[model samples]
Target: MGTIKDDASLVEQALLQDEESKRYTGDGSVDFKGRPVLKQNTGTWKACPFILGSECCERLAGYGIGINLVSYLTNKLHEGNVSAARTVSTWTGTYFITPLIGAVLADAYWGRYWTIAGFSIIYFIGMCILTLSASIPALRPVECLGSICPPATPTQYVVFFLGLYLIALGTGGIKACASPFGADQFDDTDSEERIKKGSFFNWFFFFVNTGALVSFTFIVWIQDNAGWGLGFGIPTLFMGLSIGCFFLGTPLYRFQKPGESPITRLCQVVIASVRKRDLVVPEDSSLLYETPNKSFVLEGSRKLEHSEELR
Candidate 1:
């Protein structure tokens, strides 16, 4: 009986120690360092292939569209040099500026997944419209009517410009958000995974360039010989496939709610400071009585106090 009681106490003590150790284990809880490590094994690495695949496909489609866009606008669209230049400028400006908008939208409203998916649909629609405009001569009359009025005759060039603008809007959204979205997938808290995340950007760019190289070399030739419809159509097909591929890994992708950007936070701080400056203060306050003075021993402290009083 004595031996059995001693053994029971030993068992209880062991159980208590086990529970305490688990509670204190650095890996088991939600500390900043531990959270990331815990998430590392939660299927993030498996999702990387899909992200990389989407990146490659996006680059391919973009390059395919780019390599032939000038020629398509000038020659196939049948525009004068002046008209083509203006159209190109408009298209380029829209393409560049819309990305900033897309980034803001992605961060503030849409998560990366939704942003990519939504923009991809828009991209597909834009590609379809471009292909349709290039293929069907009859649709050109309606589409180009605005560009071709009494002052300016409707031209295939006008249709091309409209199509290019739509494509720009779509591509801008994707370009701005996709990479950052992909990076978001890796759990950065784990040291090994953090290293992998760092490596992902490099690999992402490499694959994108590879896709671009292929598209520029081959897709351009197909467009040059096969006709505009087929040229644009190929990219449209690839974009669709890319979208499908992205969706395939949706379950594996980790999402982060967009937060205020550093610039935005800085701007907010500045605005708040300005507003505070404009605030009315009670006349009798001790801060209102503070004065600036120069003294070597306490000059810095005095200056800070004076500044705070002014604020």
Candidate 2:
């Protein structure tokens, strides 16, 4: 492969390759490594379906959990009417905040794959807790360990809250990084592959929504009819499947090493600009211009005038 300089060179290389393959009719003047290039079979689009399937599964998992979450907290957990609102709010906040933590951890400590896997384990534990809470209602009296116990209190609410927080954290990590990670699979230097990458995001989201719709309609309905355990369990199952699917594509997936952010680069530029002696003015009355003409002078002119005054 030839070294790529810019977009124009990439496009030209693509067109030249196409011409050599007889996929396009043109004079084959372009040479690769001093030899007349012949057309090579680029192969069929195999990975597109896998990408779409993964996205669909992800959306389904998200939608299923989201649509049923509030009802699960209030109804299944049997949180009192007043406390239900606060409980739901807490759940929502944790879900949103975990992503920021996940992103930071992913960039600084865990690579994307490992971060996703670790969080997924935490998510599964949360699901198990939710299931246990729903199953064992009598455990509610043990709140805070050694606190006064109210007889016959339900523990479902406590379990549900803990579970929801875990799921939120896992979702935050996966949502922040997966798309960009997936996009890294395509080689952008190749024009044909680059065009395919542009279309990848569109299909990625489409499958996600499809999964969500299925999860919402089916998972919620199952929970309503069968039991809370089955309802929460359904999402757990799908999430597990989604994780497996992600790993299946691991061989084909491209991994990009994390690097410093643009903000860091910008701050460096600003610090360097500020540190130059010529860029900073001294805090002295003697250096101040005393005349009206000096007030309207440009920076270079002021410097020249100050030098002249010194002479």
Candidate 3:
């Protein structure tokens, strides 16, 4: 904020435009078209405690599982070190990379709020299934045959991977929306609110580390000393609490409409340029067909026809 100067960018103006569109009703909810009317709340530091607290718990729940994943695979699953490492790597890679897909879904279709909410359920379900697989006799390895450990049966494989990949998908959605959603709670127009929003990111990272720390220490200990079931179960409980806290803050959240997808805009640009390639290039910028309204057109971009007739 300090270093950057000059005029505000088009995205900033678009953000302001979004803030302006929020129609606050006398009722608890605000008027938004696609989803159910969102609970109206001012985006302020005062109202952001719920979002922060929810994030802490969500991190704790999510981190608890991954931190000790190698141990669980090696000890309980009776997997060799190399195999366990590979499995953990694949699982984590999937968890992180799927966010790109989720971001498109969030920005292009579902708004951030609903994307987070919907995915939180999927995450919770994954946690439950993972816990169940860890605990149940049939889901994990049965008896060790002499020196070599038996591989997981087809059913066990299905149960375990289902839990693992659901987690991947769910975490992807959460990662895409959570931070931006948190920042969305602040009114960017106000100097004070904008500062608070910037300050919030610093605190958010702090809390995130706190979650990872606790999971690595306490949660891992429980799994090692007590049982895998108890370890995995604790995170599931925290995840539920995380979801509950998120919903509880509905009245305090600063909701926004989903932004347009860059991919879609780019594709539109390409299509329009290619279709008009052989035609004479217009000398005047005004000659290009454009919509007057800023609401629908890409910010700081040449407005393309909204109609498919551009083809």
Per-residue lDDT tens digits for candidate 1, residues 1-311, read 99999999999999998766533312222222223223533334677788889878878887788766777765655567787677677777787788876777776676566778888788778777777877886544333454562222365545555666777888767888878777765544345655777788888899899889989888899899988778888888888888888889876666655545536757987998888996889776765645543421221111222355446
| lDDT for each candidate structure | 0.69, 0.59, 0.77
For model 3, give the 10-residue run with minimal summed lDDT: 25-34
**Between candidates 1 and 2, the TM-score winner:** 1
Between prediction 1 and prediction 2, the one with superior lDDT is: 1
* Ordered list by lDDT, greatest first: 3, 1, 2
Q: What are the per-residue Cα lDDT tens digits for candidate 3 across 54-135?
A: 7888888888988889888887788889999999999999999988977888777777788989998999999999999999
State the lDDT at 50 in candidate 2: 49
Off by over 4 Å in 1: 1-43, 140-159, 260-264, 272-311
lDDT (10s digit) by residue, model 2, range 135-177: 6646333333354433334344455567767778778777777
Best by TM-score: 3
Please, what is the TM-score per model? Answer: 0.70, 0.64, 0.75
Candidate order by decreasing TM-score: 3, 1, 2
The C-alpha local distance difference test score for the whole of candidate 3 amounts to: 0.77
